[model samples]
Target: MAFWTYMLRCVDGHYYVGHTDDLDARIAGHQSGLIGGYTQKRRPVKLVWWQEFPSRAEALAAERQIKGWSRAKKQALIAGDWESISRLARSRSCR
Candidate 1:
């Protein structure tokens, strides 16, 4: 089974990051508010992005990394703009 790192864009326009072994089930729970957390209150979230990893640890690590990103960086990622993502990272470091 592959582990997944996923991002949800909530109705409030905020993003939530998480890692799970059962991606579909997890997303379903979030959508139904059965998950009962950040996503639950932010209901009607859309699955904006997701990537599968070979291990849970890797997925968790990716989740943590994304959670720290700025909204712009996350948007760049969602748009699959790697160049913009890299530029944003460099700009951050130079600050």
Candidate 2:
């Protein structure tokens, strides 16, 4: 069972983070507004980042950790700026 922690860029520019075992179907639900939740009000969502974990626990932990990141750090991650991401992570760890 492959679980994924995904980040979505919402219509209003906010980010949503969640974990699911079904990536494609989950994203579809978000896009179609079929899932009545926070994302539903946000309407269209774009998958800006994702990571695969071998276990559900790992995926969920990563999701929770990412959710705590500042918007700038999150955007850096989404932009694939590994240098900035590493710096942010290290800075956070020291705090």
Highest TM-score: give the candidate number.
1
Every candidate's lDDT: 0.96, 0.95
Model 2 C-alpha lDDT per residue in residues 9-89, reported as the tens digit of each score:
999999999999999999999999998898999978999999999999999999999999999899998999999998988
Our model 2 lands, by Cα RMSD against the true structure, at: 1.4
- Where is the poorest 10-residue window by lDDT in model 1? 36-45
Off by over 4 Å in 1: none
- TM-score of predicted structure 2: 0.91
RMSD of each: 0.6, 1.4
lDDT tens digits by residue: candidate 1, 2-93: 99999999999999999999999999999999998799999999999999999999999999999999999999999999999999999999
Instruction: In model 1, state the lDDT of residue 35.
Output: 94
Clashing pairs in 1: none
